[model samples]
Target: MRRVAMMRATFPDALVTGHEPLIPAMTNDPKDRHVLAAAVRADAAVIVTTNLKDFPSAALAPYDIDAVSPDDFLLNQLELNRIATLTCVVDMAHARNRPPVRPVELLDRFSVIAPQFAEEAKAQILNQSEPSPWLIHQRREID
Candidate 1:
């Protein structure tokens, strides 16, 4: 099972559930389709998954399940957790097994992939008005 650390911390009151392994269809099994179906049955609005192609939004339209990528899911989590999206980006960049980024250069790096989101992330970081790395990492989220 995925740790989903952010979700656990932010949504302490949320009713999070996961299904046991079930045999899926030959073409559909092992895809996000099974998870999406379960979420649909549970009346969930969003289906968070790393495999975006497997959980194409078109297939989930009937169930109103909007498939979101891991990055997007993490950004949404940051917004809800009161942790600046930029801070999360920086953390993600550093946490990655590859190269680490300078905290000051976060916007420069993230803008390449998501320019608008980078701006929003910067705004959230600047407006928070403090430079505590620990505070940036540890947020007390409200549901």
Candidate 2:
């Protein structure tokens, strides 16, 4: 797409490397150990991962970090803020008009990844319990 033609490779502001030695022995997967170690280095509370089995709770509990699938993460976020989450999804759907995706169709695709989130979001939307767009709180001013 023309929008992405000149885009540079993106990276997080913080970079963690050479964390192999910091990895816990309980993190059995040699390939993914560095990911946990990097999380520890970055002091992240959660690791959004599709490979949860590789980062079991037993290994992550000591580091006070959690490994969750993208779906589970989205579900947890939806639970925390249904209005904002749905609003975001709706906005994204609207923005994707070139391909012409409906909000429900987008939600349907989300259902494949996060069934619980999709179900709960649908229920909330259909019930009209979510506040209007204007009701969402303003972003907090950064210090």
Candidate 3:
């Protein structure tokens, strides 16, 4: 929720998308289809979820949506950390935390591992929703 709220505050004009019907099988209230429908509508390139098997590749192939894990998503964020400008701190954190993650260690570990997976994961995170208004506003600001 922090990330979602951040996007709202940071990129208010960003286009964020979500599955409308929300597949019935995947939910208690179950709709006609799952997130796939929404992703298809939005033409998403990646869909981040732990349930990779739940969303079969063949099913998503038509829409060109690639299912990715949270690890992959975090890695993508790390890779794209340049935009957020946390390179030095993130690198230091990663270097400090090597393996056998404890809670505190995990945070530092993610900082380092995230960048490696950025190329593949960045698209999924952005595709999770349309650009937020803030993001759109930032674009205008940049222009």
- Choose the strongest candidate by TM-score: 2
Clash numbers, per candidate: 0, 0, 26
Instruction: For residues 2-83, write the lDDT of model 3, one tens digit per residue.
Output: 8699779978854545655444323211232456666666677888776667677767766667888866765665567734
How does residue 108 of candidate 1 score in lDDT? Answer: 58
Quote the positional error of residue 65 for candidate 1 in Å.
Answer: 0.7
lDDT against true structure, model 2: 0.71
Global lDDT of each candidate: 0.57, 0.71, 0.52
lDDT, candidate 1, 1-143, per-residue tens: 34577767768855435433322421233555557646755678887665677766557676666877655765676668645554565666556454655543566565665555566665665556774675455333200
Tell me the alpha-carbon RMSD of every candidate: 7.9, 6.7, 12.7
State which candidate, 1 or 2, has the greater TM-score.
2
| Alpha-carbon runs more than 4 Å astray in model 3 | 1-4, 13-34, 74-143
User: What shift in Å separates residue 5 of candidate 2 from its native position after superposition?
Assistant: 9.5
As for candidate 2, its clashing pairs are none
Error of 2 at 105 (Å): 1.1
RMSD (CA, Å), candidate 2 to true, equals 6.7
